[model samples]
Target: MLQTIHDLYDELERHRVMLSFQGPLSTDLITALLGAVERKMEGLEPDQRTRRRVFNVVMECLQNLFHHNANLTIHEGTTRTTDLPHGVVMIAQADQGYQVLTGNFMAGADVERLKGHLDRINALPPDQLREFYRETLADGTYSNKGGGGLGMIDIARKSGGKLEYGFVPYDKDKAFFSLNVNVTN
Candidate 1:
């Protein structure tokens, strides 16, 4: 236990961000997270644009988590799954800017679809990205999963850079999806 805690501390120190939560996620928890981050940022002198970007990105990430996290429920006779997916969200101050990362477990097919969408969005030039976003919203193909697929595109465009992403196989049947966005000051 001591060694595990020590390792976690070392990892947090290296990343300049601390790992804090595990277990059920809820709206109140998300609000507390935003509050904690705001308090942390109070000591720093980040510019207005950087601060606003950070705030927007953080909210989007949290909302995505709330909507998509793996669901769990216990009933009288059986167990059931819900739409919400399990995930982690982290925000950190890096040398160039703030970095927001969210990770969750997903099925292989969903992971592939997400990757393709991310690749397509990342490939677009700013003008094309705007057009694509408008088209997506106008076309009404947003998945039952609740995102218009425009969120990732908008994040990429607004960040003025490519989105950083990674996928790691977590088990025989599950893979971890991570999305990273950087907002420069």
Candidate 2:
């Protein structure tokens, strides 16, 4: 058991990870993480703009996880279920600046809609993306779960890079979704 945790530590160190957490997330936990990450960035990140962009992207990602993640159930020989919004969040060093990566389980039903919307967002230039963000905000319609793609659009704008995402099938009813956002210096 110690060896396994040591291996995990080595991997994180190799990746230059500054912060990481994986478990069920709550509003209070998210609030605490935001404050802690902001302080961590202040100490390590010298440039004010880069720090703000990284912090903003992290906030948006955490909000999305909080609002959208589905509970995960694993069936190996016995059934194991994790209730609440179980997810992972990591902030790591990148060649240009920093990378904020988040992962969570989501309903299989949402995959297509989210994929298409993200594809469209990636296709647009900065000006078009900003306009699209405005349109989404002005539409004044929020999904039953909350958010009208505004958080994602805002993430893209603040990161100044295309959002990278992938889905791995977990079951017929759900999938593990991961998103990677880069905030360059």
- lDDT computed for candidate 2: 0.90
lDDT of 2 by residue, 5-90 (tens): 99999999999998899998878999999999999999989999999999999999998988787673445655344555789999
Give a tens-digit lDDT track for model 1, residues 38-66. Answer: 76766663576766677677777777766
TM-score of each: 0.79, 0.89
Model 2 scores a TM of 0.89
Stretches off by above 4 angstroms in model 1 are 1-11, 18-20, 70-84, 171-173
* Stretches of model 2 off by over 4 angstroms after superposition: 3-5, 72-82
* Backbone collision tally, model 1: 8
> What are the per-model C-alpha RMSD values against the true structure?
3.4, 4.3
